[model samples]
Target: MIGFYGDIVFETSNSRILTFSELQRSTASRWAKHEVIGKKPTSEFIGPDLDTVSFTVNLNGQYGVHPRDEMNRWLIKARSGTAETFVIGNKRIGVDKWVVKSVSQMWGVILNKGEVVTGKVDIELEEYVERL
Candidate 1:
């Protein structure tokens, strides 16, 4: 079986590709320094397991392999009152702000010779923001 997680793509003017995991690590590093202190850090996990922190992908859209010469870019949109946006890179570069027009859910499927498998994903941005 295949699994999916938060995946972001970044396109730089200088021709660079940035993945979501790379961006999250960078952001977490910066937050670890100033915000967290002493034994209990500000960014420390607060759930059943320390490893299961609420980390998410903040990508603008779907991504796939593209032919050369395409101007691929990474952009993110959030509401005005959103606080402490956890961007993968420097917010100034990684995100392009826009009003959220709508939110929706998506699913995927796979089929074999005699069987079909389906997967579902539901993301609620409002719920995540509330936790933050």
Candidate 2:
């Protein structure tokens, strides 16, 4: 199984699309390995300003047993390809973001401390940027 974390962008050309990434060398390395070698390594290269798709949790209040207003944000962009999802850890909660966590021909989903509830690929995007 192989997975990477970064922002994906896609461009349309003649009814076709091209994908690009703004990821770190480490994530890029892992992606390359999976693309070329067909195997997953143990670790990945970590760098600065790595734009990988991740979930941000806002821990405002509430503690012990039940929490209060836990909102998860998904940072998605254009150009990202298909991905897979998985469930990790002990907590079980409905996921709003596309979850792809593992090493396979499919994209892997990442969990905070390996705590996943449910996951799936959500590929839907609209043009958000224009250059004139």
Candidate 3:
């Protein structure tokens, strides 16, 4: 198993061909600039911004994965604003749960029956923190 986003598992098996690539993570700090009369503006640290993660997943029916079905799962979660735990190699991704920020799909191979045989999905996730 490579990693998992909520209930969607990324793995390779005789009957399932789901895996990820081009995984990228980003972190940022919130800073504010204070204007100065004569000198350079001073900066004030506000806090830490939410971390973001982006990756691409390839789906192929020949490897045992249904592209449309898997893509629907991601769309459903993103539409509902669901926060789910993300794990990769037995390690959690962020400080708290992560929400699906976006899901972009590209259909590569399709048959005459309009069945998608191969496709790729790019997913973006942001850290989810509960309000006190």
Q: How do all models score by TM-score?
A: 0.18, 0.17, 0.95
Task: Assess candidate 2 and give its lDDT.
Answer: 0.26
Every model's Cα RMSD, please?
Answer: 16.5, 19.0, 1.1
The better candidate by TM-score, 1 or 2, is 1
Please list the residue runs of candidate 1 whose C-alpha ends up more than 4 Å from where it truly belongs after superposition: 1-85, 92-105, 113-122, 127-132
Candidates in descending TM-score order: 3, 1, 2
Error of 2 at 96 (Å): 26
The parts of candidate 3 lying over 4 Å away from their true place are none
How far in Å is the alpha carbon of 83 misplaced in model 1? 12
Model 1, position 30, has a per-residue lDDT of 21
Q: What is the lDDT of residue 41 in candidate 3?
A: 100
How do the residues 17-80 of candidate 2 rate in per-residue lDDT, one tens digit apiece? 3222332212122222224366655454443222223232212121111111111212222223
In terms of lDDT, which candidate is strongest? Answer: 3
Across 1-132, the per-residue lDDT of candidate 3 in tens digits comes to: 988888998887777768999999999999999999999999999999999999998888899888888888889998999899999989998779999999999998988888998898899999999875
**What lDDT does each candidate get?**
0.27, 0.26, 0.90
The total number of steric clashes, by the backbone 3 Å criterion, in model 1 comes to 1
